[model samples]
Target: MSDITLPSTPNKLSRYEITGYILIAAGAIVLFWGIIMFDLVTLIATGANEEVGIVFGEFGEFIGGIVGSLWALAGVFLFFATLTYQKREFELQRIELHKTQKIFQQQNFSTLYISFLNKHNDIINSLTAYDINKSEWSGTNFFVFFQEKVLSSFTQKVRTKEESAKTPELLHSFFKDYFIYHFSFYQTSLNPYLKNLSVLIKLIQRYRAETQDAGEYYSFITKAGFTQSELFLIYHVARYQLLVEFHNIDHAFDVFEDLKDELKVDRIVQQELNDENYL
Candidate 1:
């Protein structure tokens, strides 16, 4: 195979530098023509090889009159040009500083977010609960159990109730009563998890507002390596807006929709997820 090497692209400042060099070269050529070449022309016009002193006097006068004025104008132009160039440099520096601060902010957010996610994972790993039968469940299995067994039963029990939560406020009350109070152990373990999710969501949301990242933060959550069980648990958390009175688990909806395929399997759960209160 033939070697292929493309030339490096020049930056805007380098192009400006090249232009300055060309201007300097042109100015040097003009200076040589005015000072030395013009004196030779004067000598030729006089046709007086012995009258060198008069030619020298005329040369000195020409320099004093024309070249001095040219230098003065050039100096003024150079002064302004220097100011403009310095202004451009300072503007470029300001842009770089803003970018650096933004990158630093994102880095800090990412570190905090990942730490929260790890803490989220840690919370999941930290799960432990006992059902009504005193049967043991832990971690992902516990959520799977809660989703398949507990939440399922609760919906079935509430299905025919005329008072079943149909509004956001009612649903909040419903979740607290049926889920939080009844399954105290689960909610206990779930407290820190929900709290962490709320903080993470708000962090992303605030970042979204400041940076206009536009759904990028949601990608981080979806791709944060959530298990099916963890997503299932989170969906219900958003569904009822659990712990939302104090924090922002409401933003979990962003994560839930990104992983909504998992929510489609159960009809009642699916309907509830699509409910205006939830969606």
Candidate 2:
């Protein structure tokens, strides 16, 4: 599973809610005190002179009543406003919690373990046949091979400006066939690394569908809290495996670039490429 930590409960109050509560409390207390004071004064004046008391009492009641009612109304408004704010806060928290849980579930180890197990024999056979040490192969080597064999060859027919007009259609067809061919290859070979690559691509596609907005999708992944090295490892491994699968390298590279740009980690990817001796 990813090392990402789940979000903790927030102690902070919703925006303007603290201020609203304070205002409501203060208004209620002041209103209550004013009403009590008016009642006490009226009673004392009635004992002195009935007629004068009645006039003073009625006048005081009218002014005090209006003031108290206004205060009570204001308090009520603030109370409801505060409640609305709290409700919105709760909704936001719930969404964040759901997202975090989904991320955890997606990153669970069982999926990767199963994928690895399924491809164990293929991994061993490939290693034995090629007599290649895994450590000797780097992302740079994979990228170089992809550029030369996949991208160059795929675009070779569109060499002239007029032919370039059909470049988009050609590129579309290339990716379509690329995915179809690789899907079959991976199914037969059961290459664990390629399987992982396929999984990552599907995950991204699912997220994009859910979010519907590129910015939001980017933010969601960034907030999932993957470390720089972890991000590099994911992109690197997936890119290399895609190249090995003879998939659309340019399209895959675009996805890689988009992720790095969204996460503000372009430098990290660049550093990895720089460190690769195969470049």
Top candidate, metric TM-score: 1
lDDT of each: 0.62, 0.46
lDDT of 1 by residue, 121-195 (tens): 887778877777998888878777766664565566556556444654544444445554444646777778767
lDDT of 2: 0.46
After TM-score superposition, the amount by which residue 271's alpha carbon in candidate 1 deviates from its true location, in angstroms, is: 8.0
Candidate 1, run of 10 with poorest lDDT: 1-10
How high a TM-score does candidate 2 get?
A: 0.36
Q: Write the per-residue lDDT of candidate 2 for residues 34-116, one digit (tens) a residue.
A: 55755655666555576656756665676567655655665676677677767767777877887787767556634653454
Candidate 2: pairs in clash: none
